[model samples]
Target: MTSLFPTTLFRPAAAVVAIAAALAPMVSLAAEPFVLQDIRVEGLQRTDPGTVFAALPFRVGETYTDDKAAAALRALFATGLFKDVRIEIDGKVAIVIVEERPVIQSVNFVGLKEFDKDVLIKSLRDAGIGEGLPFDKALVDRAEQEIKRQYLSRSLYGAEVVTTITPTDRNRVNVSFTMTEGDAAKIKEIRIVGTKAFGESTLKDLMDLTAGGWLTWYTKNDRYSRAKLNADLDTIRAYYLNRGYLEFAITSTQVTISPDKQDISITITVQEGQPYTVTAVRLQGEYFGREDQFRSLVTVRPGEAYQASGVAATVKAFTDLFATYGHAFARVEPRTEVDRATGQVALTLVADPQRRVYVRRIDVAGNTRTRDEVVRREFRQLESSWYDGERIKLSRDRVDRLGYFKEVAVETNEVANSPDQVDLVVNVTEKPTGNLQVGMSFSSADRLAFSASVRQDNVFGSGNYLGLELNTSKNARSLVFSTMDPYFTVDGISRSIDLFYRTSRPYNSLGDQYQISNPGGSVRFGVPFTEYDTVFFGIGLEQTNIGATAGIPNQYFDYRFRYGPRSTSLPLTIGWARDQRDSALTPTAGRYQRVNLEWSAGGDVRYLRSNLQYQQFFPIGSKLTLGLNAELGYGKGLGGRPYPVFKNFYGGGLGSVRVFEQGSLGVIDPTGAYIGGASKFNLNSELYFPVPGTGNDKSLRIFAFADMGNVWREGERLDAKSLRASAGFGLSWISPVGPLKLSWGTPLRSQPTDRIQRFQFQIGTAF
Candidate 1:
């Protein structure tokens, strides 16, 4: 030591250095005795003291270090509710200092014209920005951004938002957001480019994409959305493929927006390839029986253009034919061979009949509103037997005809773990099949009128029909009840019965008005003779009570008086019906024809009446459908008797001719009163069109039609020249309530004495 301290300083210097080292160690030992006993916190408004102590790194009796003090400060700041944090140590005590953030007191909205106050508050709360929540700079920024997004979706591109924060008592704060929602943008136009196969107008008619239309109010298809545009493209593709344009393709599509963000436009590009024509067809398959029998069913003819629908029909027919031979497992595959050079095609048919297996079980699903018995009643074939395609197809058609479902489909499911069993699933989607209507109307002659009716196509979920109606209008009073069983017999026979009491007061402007009341009941049965034929018979009794009124035609009163009360008679009815409409409410294609005849044996006026009607629908190319309908009716009183006024025919209006007024087209008296009619005839033709820009017009149709019809007294025979003819346009829209029809009819032929009726229109009618 003496040598190190300049050994020469002195021998005493060495002894002094040794003493200092020993004393310094003793000082450190004494300082270590003063240990940290507890930790204390302040400036805690919302936070608990125990929470702060639990977060401390240095506990009681633990040595204090710089790292421990730094950790405490860091943890306090991590709470996200402090603006400042400080830690201090004094001897054996530790102190934590913090400036707590303000709490949200009451959040409110002002000048919030677009959104509700409660809704906005809830949205803020979801975004971690609401009352009772700690204030944060990052969260407030995120909330502002979210509000902007919500407004943009509503087309409020110019909307604005502003936030305000104010301090309150108890170290709390209040937040409010002010917003102004701007007007929504509207679509300007829609354009299609590079399309040749179909006209621009025609293509637009098939698309849901449009600038604006009635459906836009609900579906908002007018909005410029990518998803809607893509869907439209798919629609276009299906239109072409269904028509045998196999090579059609969509190259590209572009949607442009206006700089002002107030308008939008869409452009679609398409490539139409050469259409294929049929040149030849050959069948290459094993025919178990006579091959000639199967060949006769082919509807496809050589030299005709290839049509996908016709091809599919042929396959279906072939499969059905196989069923008659008990080969229900037969499969028919149709392949198309194309010759690009000649733009021609050849169809190759191949038949493969797998093992014939009996149907072990029939399963039904998706009939949420219909009972299983209703579906089972429509099955023509029994389960636990071999599958027959013919019966299966018929079963599907029967289910579809029930009218309780919107869609009926049969899916063949292969059974697992059972090689010889196949399951047939009949799926049906239920639709509203019951109708309830109540109406009140006011007329110049009648102060008030009311009518109510309840009709159900599916009764008790059994696919039957029942109806009751009552009308209390001043001009008409009626009570009626009816029931029908579409499938009364296992062989598809139908049964029906009707009971009614009706009274009608004729409108007579001159001398007097005639009124009569009749009460009767009838029962009938229908027996199917063929696929498109039926025979029916019935009997009934009735009583008529005529009320005499001034200006009433004496001839009508005389006939009613001739028929005795409680007239017993044997009535006979026969009818034939065949319907093949694509859709009943709005038919696009197919034909329907019916003829009915009725005869009374014992009555004041013995008579026979026959009515015939035929309707046909034909699709012109792919864009238009033409419909033609015609009806003829004739009746003659036997044994020199007078015709019944109630049984007489009345013309005009939607039922007869639209241009003419209701009950105004028949022979009239000098007082401008209508006499009974014994003969009638009607003819109508209409051309249907799709709305300018919309999807298929399944729920609505616009048409232009020509109608000609008239009624004549028994002595007055039906004549074409005497018929009243009208030509005009009309619209049919299927509303939730019922069908609404509006027509503008102008008489094609009119005379000064014939009333010269003006254009007429009507809405909400029963078909």
Candidate 2:
């Protein structure tokens, strides 16, 4: 008997030709065919022997030939479980030997602060390198490089990563990656060269990227990033193009890092050519037989400086108009013809309304916590309907207004093999909609106030709002519970229920003995009359108890004497509100208006109260905004009964006129207590600008404001001379906790008896 050793090992890592060449000699030596008695696999640790046998070409008692041996070798090596495979034949028996690759037992990271451990593990797993898989040294090396690359993207120039493998029991290995993440590189200098039309500083100011500044530590604008630089370049390009620099071009940009790898310098060279004026504007293309309507949307005009923004707006308007007519794939191309001698350009807009399509389906994604119906119900562009850009935009805005999602986006996708069909996908990124707040505040009137609230805007993903609040202060105390169902009915009518108990006292030197205790509950329904308007109707029952204290005001005694100490009233409310602000929290542009009317008809206290408010914001340039607000309030007696003192409108507070103490601008009683009045008017104007060194961030701003307002008793003439005026400067911050406003005002017009509080601040208030 002769024992033959193939002496050649087969591995998938090696080339097929090399593997086949090594097996050629074995095949030639085993040319004679023989029937195998038994087949046995060797060197199997973690892998089961059945796995090797399953990949073999022949079973026990089968004829094994040279071709079968070659096929078996190829088959076993393809499993990737073995690093080395060989075959031996002795006396009609076949022997199989496989050296299994070590499996990865565990993966870990050390000194990795820039990324989470799971994040790196997931990244490695995506690259076929994770625990419970066959370990490949090449894949581990690539993963180390990938980790370093991620650090570099965050401006960590000096970051280093090292991979260590430790052999464990059962032919397994544990992988460890150690990383050293250094400080991020900062932009030391940013220089713009060859700028004549605009000052270099002005051009640089338009960019979001900047050199090190006092606020850079917070904004991170000083950190060097390739993506940020590219965005800044685009901004610069747009700036020049909008200013009529039709031939403006960025010649080159150079970035250099210091030897220490902590400092970076950027240089951008731009060519500012001659400015151009529009010679003529022409429209050319299919207009769906409504050329006049499309022409009305053109903004590029002759005898004016060429503005890229105007051209872009005109193109967008044309495309959007087409989209509104079911042309979902509309395209508007603007072509420009420039004459160097005259420095004049001719602009032509070309519109192409491609195949019209109707939405075949609507899908919502990324709403892991929110229900699908909560998002679907907001859609105005229904499935199976012709595409309408305006309705789609309205739907997106409505979803955004819910304030439940951090981001909402609508994407259109063409249906496969269907030219006239499309799909609309609404993607929403949900944020935490539940908030628990416990805080302390101070004011001139409500001194040392403590408040607590628990609120959920998206309760159980039902798109309902529930909240409970408790507030206590030196002059007032209150507890309230409220709930709202935005979609109470399919018609978009909203229902709100509130139950509250409150106590109040006049802000005077006198103690809290002179107080008013009030408790009430109300249910309101909001009916949407338009896309931006809502009318509300509700009824509430309240009881006002005027305390018969030692220092009680004459007005309070008058009301109590007429309606008794405890007065019960049923008030009916009707209100309308319209909001078109770009943002409710920090509005830069748009208008808001609200009017509310309350009437108590069938109660001991019969009166009418009406309030109207209007607010508008105008954006000035890119970094400044102008805001204006006006309010008028009136309360009149009815059915031969005077207006209730508890329902009187008060002025002079953070939300009203600043500088004067809260609720102190109304009529004063002989006892020196501020008795709030029945009629009020306020006018406020503010100029807001970004904080210096903060770039274009609107979250933090500084504003100068002028406020004028006054409160008058019932039947008192509305006199301009009686209004108190103030001018002040303040800082506004949309902080993580809430919106904060701090103001220091000086009275521009005041009387000697007016109580003044110059420095004032409040949280959760926006104007």
Candidate 3:
């Protein structure tokens, strides 16, 4: 029972006794009720006078008794504004003496660095310690403790917080908190006690947390995080389970912080149980009478290793299949029976096709700059329609693929009083889709080049792409402007417009450079034939002018003689691309193929050009990937005309055969000048490995590459004997400015007269 009056700090029971003793006189005098009394409150600095009168048990003309006094005391105490209360009566008049708690006049923070000041102030305000509120020492202490806890969560174990309060005029107090945030405890060691199937080094590679690394400051891979450790443990479990160890378990984990609170150590114990192989697999589920189609989705087979990943995939397939039938609540359960003696397991998958549900509403949020319709158009699921898991997942993926958001999430919330309805929330975190760049790059052939670009991917939040680029190099100077509107048509057809002016002095085999000036523009539309496929068709007009220079290639003069100093053409292009890569910038596992065809019919030199390319990336291990790319290009004259000398393909630079100088490959003219070929092919294969000191950072990597290719002149057949090849290694960094690549190639199959350029670099190519 709380006292109606303030109790002693040292002994609350004794204080209660004293309070009663002091009230005994009033109790005896109040045996008989008296009327016609006036009540007056003594202590009133900030509280309203009317409030005290309303809380008094006795009115001005009502009876004043002992019960009234006690009730009044309880009322005042319940208000939490007063600490002391006393009542006295003289001549049928009651006088009330009260002591009010000090109000908080101001609050301040000092020496806090780990958190923003506004955030800390709001946190403390939530804890009932801030300006304009009543001050309590206990609450202040708790706020200080909370501050320390927040720091500890961020690995600042040595942090400290101290709070101080000073009384002010009119019974007010000022509060201040001082915090000292120390160094974050970094992980000094991590040990895996038992490992048999895989080496410790390989297992460690699967975890993102490292004891120490060169990029620890940026990656924070050395700091101890409980959530990261849990994720790491999950990866370890998945690794063993996917490799056939069904009974694998993490036995124990210990995290020890050093006495100085600046270093941390972690140790983990694991049990690698006997590997299990599948003896048989059977499925018993409600597939809506489509068992044959569903059965084929199962990848697990008899006599194969018991693979958890395959089982999970089969389960998802079954679930997705049910979802296609509007079974929104469907679930597939897997049951395994293991035989220890035979080291085998029999698996059975059971399904429960629950009731269907419809989407009540689809709300989009967190797009501060982008319009809601910009996000809604990508969703395949519609409101008021039956919920489909496959469509919902695709909707989320489509939004992510836009590359406008840094993070995208979809959440399903059950509507109240509507068991069959759910609301979907597509939350996105917007990122800066605009960029302004000015930088320089150097290479052995290009020397030093300067470039700049202004691009916006989500212009005015309308989901349009606009870019202007300028590059000034020793052999080339160009300016280009481009724009693309992805929603040009409601059905998701994209339209692209481009205009460019370029002046190029291309290098030839004879070390001669001739200037070619061309200005062109094109308009293209991409029609999506399927989810992953697109067909683009475009028309363009270009005018090319050649400038004769001293020691220029003879082919340039010959083209000027046949087609005049300047010529114009109307070019038509048709292209097809199917991209299944997971990322546009850095793909881990996928295949991309494209074929582009171009022709110019109305020109002095009519020609046709075709290029076909295929690229594939295969994940070889947890930290290794294998990427292969091949391109074949050919050009031919049309209408019985000779192939245009200026319309030639050059191979042997950073983007092509790497061991030779830029544009220094192909048949040589009588003057020893390099004349580019009409046919070109390249085969590039790379084995990408994670950098050793960067932990699991995929942004930086080292790769070994083998490049083989050759260029054939017009009407010349491709021969293996004439192909050139090189094999070497390179490093790639996705730096803040841009992607940078450096390579050192060793010629393997090259002519003795070939211009050898062992080192090469490019500013923006990933491989």
Best by TM-score: 2
| Count of residue pairs whose backbone atoms collide, per candidate | 7, 0, 2
- lDDT by residue for model 1 (1-767), tens: 01111112212223323343344333222333346887778788888887777767778898876556655655555555665666655668777777787888877777677666666666566555677877765566657666776666555666778888888899888887777666655567877787777798888876776777766665465766566678888888777766667678888887666777777777788887878788888888887865687778777777876766677788888888876555667899999889888888898879876666677789889988788988998787779877788788888887887778888998877788876677888888888889898987443334477889999988778878899999897777999999998788877678898999988877765846667787888887888776546777667666566675667665665554576423334556777778777877777799888888878777654777889989999998665789888888888776677556567877777757776776777877655677648888888898888655445545677789898888888877566678778888877778765576667868887666665445554444522
* The 10-residue segment with the lowest total lDDT in model 1: 1-10
lDDT of 3: 0.84
lDDT of 2: 0.87
lDDT of each: 0.72, 0.87, 0.84
Q: For candidate 2, lDDT tens digit of each residue in 486-598?
A: 99999999999999999986655565458789999999999999998899999999988888988888888887786689988899999999999888888999999999999
| Of 1 and 3, the candidate ranking higher by lDDT | 3
TM-score of each: 0.69, 0.84, 0.78
Query: How many Å off is the CA of 242 in candidate 3?
Result: 3.0
Query: Which residue pairs show collisions in model 1?
Result: 2-7, 358-385, 358-386, 359-385, 511-551, 512-550, 512-551
The segments of candidate 1 whose C-alpha lies over 4 angstroms from its true place after superposition are: 1-193, 196-206, 213-231, 238-246, 255-262, 273-352, 366-371, 429-435, 440-449, 487-490, 560-570, 603-605, 764-767
- Please give the distance, in angstroms, between residue 102's alpha carbon in candidate 3 and its true position after superposition: 15
- How close to the true structure is residue 481 of candidate 1, measured as C-alpha lDDT? 97
